[model samples]
Target: MSTIVRVAARGDGVAEDGRHAPFAAPGDTLTEAGEIIPGPHHQPPPCRHFPQCGGCQLQHLDDESYAAFVADRIATALAAQSIDAPLRPTALSPPRTRRRATLHAERGLVGFTAEGSHAIVDMRECHVLHPALFALVAPLRALLQRLRPKGRAELHLTLADQGVDLLIRGRLPDGLAAAEALTGFAQAHALARIAVDDGYGPETRWEPQPVAVTFAGTPVPLPPAAFLQATAEGEAALVAAVREAAEGAATIADLFAGLGTFALALPGRVYAGEGARDALLALKAAAALARRPVVTEHRDLFRRPLTTAELDRFDAIVLDPPRAGAREQVAQLAASKVARLAYVSCNPSSFARDTATLCEGGWRLDWVQPVGQFRWSTHVELAAALSR
Candidate 1:
């Protein structure tokens, strides 16, 4: 018998002898004949679709083991770069708190795709999605049955400030009846907005009022398919970590500032830079309306990252790059004279690579805060504070 000691980055459990097993939690015992015996850290999956649905991967792990998995992901990545930093306790978002999700629909089935396959899981119950968002699953299944959309359709659901915002990507029958059916569905659910895409871009079908999402006490217009933090609690955790890292800084620069998640939350003046024009415009408009001292710039850091001299103007910097991490931007930041930096990332491997660059340039990693926003999944997010 072999004991599983840890969870890998791809959701597989690694045994003490380095063998891997799927759906096995830490402390689980694996027999030579390939049977897994549940252990102390293993728990019965809460959702019926546990191993089938690709929505979550670690549902079999208890809270303690799950938190360790999140931290281990970061620690392993940093170890690969020969870097060490104080790791704070992991912040985990509770179940049913996910405010945004993308589901797939085909034929009459509507749900997440099956694990390692393109087939839909036909979600009858989801433990990860917020109640408001999950409530629409059955209704969406019904709607898809009526529409009988050819091929696969994508459903993007988000809980906006007003109510649920829905976007459907598939061909729909064009007629007054189809339009009325969509309108009636939106009205019945009090949806903030509903749009459809038949190949061309999304076109709004029902929207009595403009849809928006509130960030840092300010409401910003929500663009169709705009990126948002998965869960509200997860967003709060990341924002709080950034705020703490940037404390006492009168001037800050927020890079990859999507919808002002950190720009509006931080104190003092802020320079917000983003690559998405629509998102930047929404942030600029929100700042103007709130009378916040935020300057917005539409810039692609990948091609034209802020120079060392440009980065030196700010007392602190906040970077929230995508999963690829900010290699080009970190090059400038490493050589800059900025007093402090808060780095938020969703990919530990890429983040560790950037950290190596920063450390090579004389930056010292102070601490890291791991956030398990995409709970029960191998996906991990983190916020780190660094200084010269």
Candidate 2:
């Protein structure tokens, strides 16, 4: 008999009925309104490790109910701020939309750490990633198993729609041999590109080739570590929303512009700003090829901002900031009286706060279109338009 252990429920100290079967478990049963679904299926197996593993908490619920729970979470967060928006249907994305993951390496084990702690989870399969990654996992594990380096830290895996890029934290046997091995792995798997990060390792060598990704009918080359949306479909949806909002606008300012995803696609003259030097250069290259007149400025808007004089020249503005949201910067734009402002935010709470600010500044809140970029998690990416 498999020894079943009871795990504590999330936020509740008491363990609920959920079992941790070694390889597989029972399917979660669901109940209709005012009806009780009886039997062993209804009796959930309690997880013994639930309190510790931060990976998942809703494992006991069926897939449909689990999705509703996720929607409720976002709705609750937004409701707190008195913002009412339609609860958009949750989009089911690949389990491993995680383009980049940081893993801990200890005692020859390479895997993700348990949710709240630094302890490894010993992950065999990630349900969220593209299915192709499952076949590549064994080879990745074999490669890591062969490597042993002193003072080893963590491994970072970045997967794009095109290829996989790795950032290993310790020294390898030899640079030439390691590069040859990575290239061989790529060819064997039919990968588009590969990047090895030995920046923290001894005798590091950095040689990166652009990862090719098609966007808006153009092949844009992105650096290995560059920021791209985890899901290509999600990015396309966002691009469509942005283009729709900015159509026929004269001069536009793109804030927090990474690789000019929106700037390169816009119809008119674009003034783009990004903190990353490499992203700006790549965006410039893409613009040149597309014959789009884009003047990019590499500026950290968080530290030094776009001046009022700079804001006065643009007829429309588009902002896509980091997860922190662009509260301070959005406030600046609200004061500028730009004709139409489109704000794209990954965090809904901050988006609500910032959008409220714009509303108070005489700009009308037009619509908030939600995009499921990170499919499984509580995160939401929204593109909202405000017209004065």
Candidate 3:
């Protein structure tokens, strides 16, 4: 028997001899016949859709083991780049805290897609989504049945300040009755907004009032399909880490500042740069309305990164890039004279690559804060502080 020593990045348990066991946790024993013996870290999955629903991967792991897995993911990535830093305790978002989720509906079934397949899992119960969000699943299934959509439809649910914001993408039965059904559903659920995208673009079917998402005490207008942190606790943790990293800086530049998440939270003048026009405009409007000292710029850093001269103006910098990471921007930042930076990323491998580039430019990685917002999943997020 080979004992599983650790979990790999993709959630497979690794044995000493480099063997892997699927859906196995650390300390699990694998028999010669490939049967898995559960260990202390292993527990019965809460959801019946375990190992089938693509929504979660590590439900079999206890919280302690899950935290270790999250931290190890970051450590492994950093080690790959030959970089080392103090890794703080992992901040884990509790179950049922996810405020945003995407589910699919087809043939009267509504839920996440099946693991490694396009088939829907027909979610009867979910453990990861917020109660408010999950409550709509059954209703949505019913509504879709009424509409009787011939093709599959995608449902995007986000918790806005007022209530749930739902966007449906697929063809639906078109008529006054169809319109009335959608409006009635929204009103019954008290949805903040409901939009549908048949093919061209989204059209609002029901919006009692303008929908917005609050960030750092400021309400920014919510754009259709806008990006948001999975959990509020996770966002708070990242913001706190950035604030700590850029402390005492009077001028800060927030690159890839989507909806001014980090920019509005930081103390002092903030220069917010984003590539998406709607996101940038929303942030700009929110900043102006709140009388915050945030200057908005529509710049694509991937194409035209801020030059070293332009970057030198900021006392500190904060960047929360997409999964690909800010390769082009990091190149410029590495050569800049900025004293401090807080780098936030969802992809550890990309983050480590960028960290190596910055380190080669004489910057020292101070510390890293690992955050597990997508609970029970392989995805990980982090914030790192670097200084010259």
**Model 1 lDDT tens row, 1-388:** 9999999989888998888998899999989887899999999999999899999999999999999999999999999999999999999999999999999998788899988999999999988999999999999889778877778899999999999999999888888888898999999989999999888988999899999998889999999878999999999999999999999999999999999999999999999999999999999999999999999999999999999999999999999999999999999998888879999999999999999999999999999999999989999999999998
Sort every candidate by TM-score, greatest first: 3, 1, 2
Clashing pairs in 1: none
Better of 1 and 3 by lDDT: 3
Looking at model 1, report the run of 10 residues with the lowest lDDT sum: 143-152
lDDT, each prediction: 0.94, 0.62, 0.95
Order of the predicted models by lDDT, top scorer first:
3, 1, 2
Which runs of model 3 end up more than 4 angstroms from their true locations? none
Worst 10 residues of 2 by lDDT: 6-15
| lDDT against true structure, model 1 | 0.94
The TM-scores of all predictions, comma-separated, are 0.98, 0.77, 0.99
**C-alpha lDDT of residue 19 in model 1:** 89
Error of 3 at 332 (Å): 0.4
